[model samples]
Target: MQVIKKLKDFRTLELLQKANELTLKNHSNEITLERAIFLSWWCEKGDCAFCYMSTQKPRISDPKKARRQINSILAEAELCRRMGWNIEFLSGGYGSFSTSEIKSISQDIFKITKQPVWLNIGITNDLEEYGEEISGITGAIEIANPELHDKICPSKSLEDITNMLEVAGDLGFKKAITIILGLGETPDDLEYLFNLINDLKIHRVTFYSLNPHKDTIFETQPQPASLYYAGVVAATRIMFPELEIVCGTWIDNLANIGPLIMSGANGLTKFPLFKMFGTRYGKRVEEEVYWSGRKLKGTFTDFNSLKNGADLGELNPFIKRYIDKCLNKKPLKE
Candidate 1:
C-alpha cells in the first residue's frame, strides 16, 4: 500500500522506470502477443456512448453471411497458429446469439488453434454449459465510474458483473476484465477500480484510453493524452507487479508504443494483426519496440546497430551455453 502511494508521487520518468524495473524483475523482456476475434457487431444495446460498433456495419441481420464468415475466421485462426500467433481471446455482442451457438464456434476455434479461449460472455451462470471448451471468462466493467457507468453502458450492471467474476472464481476459470480510462472518472474512482480488482483477484487486465468513435455520444471526446495514459499504465504495473497487463493502441498512436513498452505493458490487445506483418504500420511498431531494447520474435531485428545497445549476436548461443553450464557439461557443441 505504501508502495502504491509512493508510485503516485513519482514524476513521469521515475514512475516509468520503476514500473519497467518491476516488470523486468518479475516478468521478462519479451512482449507477449494477444488478439481478439470479433464474433459479431450486432450489439443489441448498441447505444454504448463510447463505442462505434453498432453504428458501423451490421452482422447479426444476415445469418447466412455470418455463418460463412465463421469459416473464413477458422481458416485465419489456423494460419495464425502456424505463424506463431495465439488466438487468446474472443469478444463480440453476445446479446444476439444463444449460448449454444457461441459454444459451437468456440469449440471449433480451440480445435484448430489449440489454445485456451478467454471469452466475454458476461453476467451468466452458464460458463459450465460450454464445459472445458471455454476455459476463461471476462466480465468487463469498462466504465467503472458509478456516476457514468449507467449513463454510458445502460445495459451493463456493476453488481451483475461482480457476481459474474465471483462465479468465475468458483469455477476455477481464468478471470479477466477491461477498463477504459478518461471517461470523466476521478481520482477516487481510480482508487476504487484498483480495490475492486484486488477484491476480485483478477488474473489479467486490458487497459484502453477512451477512444471516442464516430457518430457516438463521445464522438468529440478527445483521446486521452499519451503521457497521461502511460502514467496510468505504469501505475497499474506498480500496483500489480506480477499481474498480466495488456495495453490497447491503434496505428495512429504508434508514436507512444515505446513509452508504453517501457512502462510495463506485457502484451497488446485489439491490435490489427492483418496489418502487422507486411505493412508500414507494422514496421513502425517493430522499430518502436526495437528502440526500446525489447525482443520480439519474427521481427528479425539487428540488435547490433540499434541505439538501445542491447547486443544481439551470440545471445541465442549464450542461452545454450548457460544451459550447458548448468548441467556441468562441455561447451555448446554448436
Candidate 2:
C-alpha cells in the first residue's frame, strides 16, 4: 500500500529517500560484501533465454568436468574465513554434482571454516539429504510470473523452484530467492514477488539487474536503468522491512551501487572477494562502500595470511577428519 501510493507520486528522489529512511530506522548503517566459491561453471541444461551461462552450451554435459576439486573448494572456504567472512556460498551450477557429493562438500566446508555453508548451486530436489548441515538455500525466481518463467526456462517449472525453497524453509534452513530486473519483468511484477516471499517465509531477497553475456539471446536487451534498479530495491525494502536485501554488483554496474545503498540495499554481492591478492578491486570496493556512508562488513583484510596459505582444522579431531577427506589424506567417513 505504501509502495503503491509512492508509485502514484512517481518521484524517484522521494521514493529513494523514504526507502533510505526506512532502512536506517529499522536496520543500521551497514552493508556486507558477499563471496562465493564456484564448484563448477558447467550447467547441464543451460538454455535459459536470459542466462549468462547459456552461451557455454556443451554438446554433452560431463559431470566430471562439471565438478571442481574439493581440496580447492576447502582452501577457498578457509580463505573466506581468514578474511573474516561468516558465510560463503558454494555454487556448482545446475546438475553439476549429485546429492551425495553436495552433502560431503557441505560437511567438509562447515567443519573447516566453522561458517555455516550456504548453497547457491542451483535447485536441489532433496533437501532431506543435506538435513541440518547446510545453513541456507537459494532458489532464484528470476522471472516473477509463472508463464514468463516457463517461457524463459522451458526445461524448468515454477513448482520445482518453489518446492526447493519451501522445503528448505520447512527444514529450518534460511531460504533466499533472487529476482532479476531487466529480464522482461515489469515493475508491477514486484507485487507477485512480494506475495511469494511472504507466502514462503523467505528470510532474504537478492536483486540483480541482468548483465547479458555476449552472443546470448538477451545480448541486445538493455539492463534496467540505474534509477529503475534503485527503485526496485527501495520498493523491496519498504515491503520487506525485516528481510535481508542484497543488491548484486557486476563490474559494469559497480559505481551505480551508491544509489542502491541509499535505496535500502543492506548488502552488495560478488565483490571479487577471492581476488584479494590484487588491491585494485579491493581498494575500489572499500572506497565505494565508504562513499555511501555505510560501514562495509567482510572486506578482505588477511592479504599475507591468504597469500601464504591458511589451514582450516589443526586442533579438533572431527574437523580434522573432514579436512583430511577434502585434502584426500583419508577416506571419507560414512
Candidate 3:
C-alpha cells in the first residue's frame, strides 16, 4: 500500500502519519540496534571490479587476529545490548574468513552474550555443514544482482547464493538477505529476489543503495534517487508484511528516510555523519565511533566509547529519523 512510482504530487502529511504508526507497531521501544564488524581482508576469487576489497590480499592477515577482533566487536555488542538494542549484527568483508573461522567467531561471542547475532559475510561454499555448531548464527546472503553477481562476483554465482538460501532455509536457520539496488538490475531481479525471500522465510531483508567507493569501477556512477529506493522498500514490505526489512549502509539522509519507512522498511542501521548527515559516503557506527575517540577525544577509548555511545539516546535518531522521514514522504498520488 505504501508503494508509489513518483513523488511529484506526493502528500507529505499523510505519509508521515502512516509511517510513524508502522514504526511504533514494529519497534515498540526507543532502542538502538546492535551492530558488529567482521573484518574481510580480501574479495573472494573472481570478485567483481566494483568491490572495495577486490584487490589481491588474503581474507585475513592471520586467524590469530580474529580473537582480538571478536573481543573488540563483542565488547561493543555488550554495550549495545545494555542500551536496549535487541539485535547484534556482525558485518565485514566476505571471503575474508573460512567457515571454520566463523566457528571461532560464534564461540567467542557466545561467551559474551545471549543476544541474537547476525552474520553479514557474503555467499559461502558450505553453510549447511556448520548447522550443528552454529545454531545461534543468523545467516546473510549479500548478492544484489544475479547478472552483476556473476559479473561482480564470478567466484560465487547467483545460483550459489540461491543454493545457500535453499540450504539455510531448509535447515531452519533464521536467515537474512541483502539486495543492493542500482547495479544495472531490473524489476525482474526484484521479483525474483522477493519471491525467493518469501519462500525461504528469511528473518530480515536489507537494501543498500549502490555507492561508488573510492577507486572502484563504479566510482563515478550516481546513486539512484531516494524516491526509487522508497518505492522498492514500500513494495517489498507490502509483499512480505512480517519480514523485518532494513535500510542499510548507503541511505542518503534524514529526507531519504521518510520515503523508505512509508514504503515499508521496519528496521534500520544507524551511524553518525558519513560525509555529513544526509549524504551516503560514510563509515559504519563501530568504525566511526572507534576512530572518532581514538583521534579526537583522548579521554575516551573504543571500549569506553562503545559503552557510552550504546546508552546515548542521541545516537538512536539516525535510525528513528530515517523511518520517520520515510513516513513523511508524500504518499504516491493515486
Candidate 4:
C-alpha cells in the first residue's frame, strides 16, 4: 500500500530514504555482527557456480586449519560478548561433517559465550542428532532458489531443503529460510516463496544479492540494480512485518544498504566484508552513522559513550567513495 503508491510518486533515492527513516525509528541504533566459520569440507563438494571457492582456484581449507579458524572466531565472539553486542551468529558451508563433529563444535561455541548460534550450515539429516544439548542452536535452511540453487548447490535441491525445514520446525527450533535475489526470479515467484514460508510459521528471512564468484559459471553475470533490490526489500517488509529480515552486506555493500535499511530490514548478515569483524547488524544501525559513516569499524560502541548524539554524526569519510567505486554505481572522481 504505502510502498506501492510511493513507488510511482518518488524517485528511487527518495523512496529509499523514507524507508530507512521508518526502519531506524523502529530499531535500536546499535549494530551487531554475524560471523561465518567454515568447517572442514566447507566448499569442497557443493560449490555454487558463483562462489570463488567453487572454481578451480584451490581445494577447501584443511580440517585442522578450519578448526584453528573456528577457535579464532570464538575468541572474537568473546570480545563481542564483553561489549554486549545485540547478537552473534556462527554458520558455514554444508552438513558434510559428522554428527559428532558438528555437535562438538556447537558445544564448544556454546561454552565460550551465550550468544545465539544460528546454524547456516547444511541441513542435518537427523533432528535427534541436535537435541536439547544444543539449546542455543537456531536452524537456517539457506538458498531456496530451486533451479539456481541446483546450478550452484546441486546436492541440496528445493525438495530436499523443504524436508529439512519441516524436520527443523518440528524439533522446536527457531527456523529461518534464505532466498537469494537476482537469480532471475519473477516477482510472483518471490511473493509465493515469502508467503509460503510465512504460512509454515517460519519467522526469519534472509535475502542475498547475486554477485560473480571467481571460478563459478556466472562469474561474468551482472548484478541486479540497487533500486530494484530496494523495491524487493520493501515488498518483503510489507508482507512479513514480524519476520526477522536479514540483509547480507557481502552482497549489498554500502550503496544499496541505505534503501534496504529503510525497507524495514532489521537484521544484517555482517562480516569482514562490511568492516564489521564478526557481528550481524540486526534491525539496527550504528550510532556512528551520525558522523561521516565511512570506515568499517569491527565493533560497536555504546550509545551513551558519546557526549551528545551529535558527536556520533561524523562517519568515516571514505564510505561514499567506496560505494561509488564498488557496488552498482557509476564511478566518481577519485
TM-scores of the models, in the order given:
0.82, 0.86, 0.67, 0.70
Ranking by lDDT: 2, 1, 4, 3
lDDT for each residue of candidate 4 in 1-334, tens digit (9 for 90 to 100): 4455554454556655655555555555433344455454344455555555555325534534444344444444444444344343455555346678667777665665554355666656765677543433334333444565566566656676667767777777677776666666655455456656776777667777876675666667787677667776776666565566767655335555655666656655544432332223321334323231222223343322211212111221233222222233222222
Q: Please give the lDDT score for candidate 1.
A: 0.70
Task: Name model 4 segments beyond 4 Å from true.
Answer: 1-31, 56-70, 83-88, 132-145, 273-334
Worst 10 residues of 4 by lDDT: 304-313
Which candidate comes out best when scored by lDDT? 2
* Per-residue accuracy of model 2 over 1-334 as CA lDDT, tens digit each: 6675565466667778988888888997878876667888778878788876677665444556657767767766765565555454677668788889888888987777766787887767778888556888987688877778888887767788888888888888998887788888777777888899899988888888888778787888888888888887888888878888888877667787899998898888766554432345555667788898889776544344433334335423433443333333222222
**What is the TM-score of candidate 2?**
0.86
* Model 1 steric clash pairs: none
lDDT of 2 at 218: 83
lDDT of each: 0.70, 0.73, 0.52, 0.53
TM-score attained by model 4: 0.70
What candidate 1 gets wrong by more than 4 Å, as runs, is 1-10, 56-68, 297-334
Task: Identify the candidate with maximal TM-score.
Answer: 2
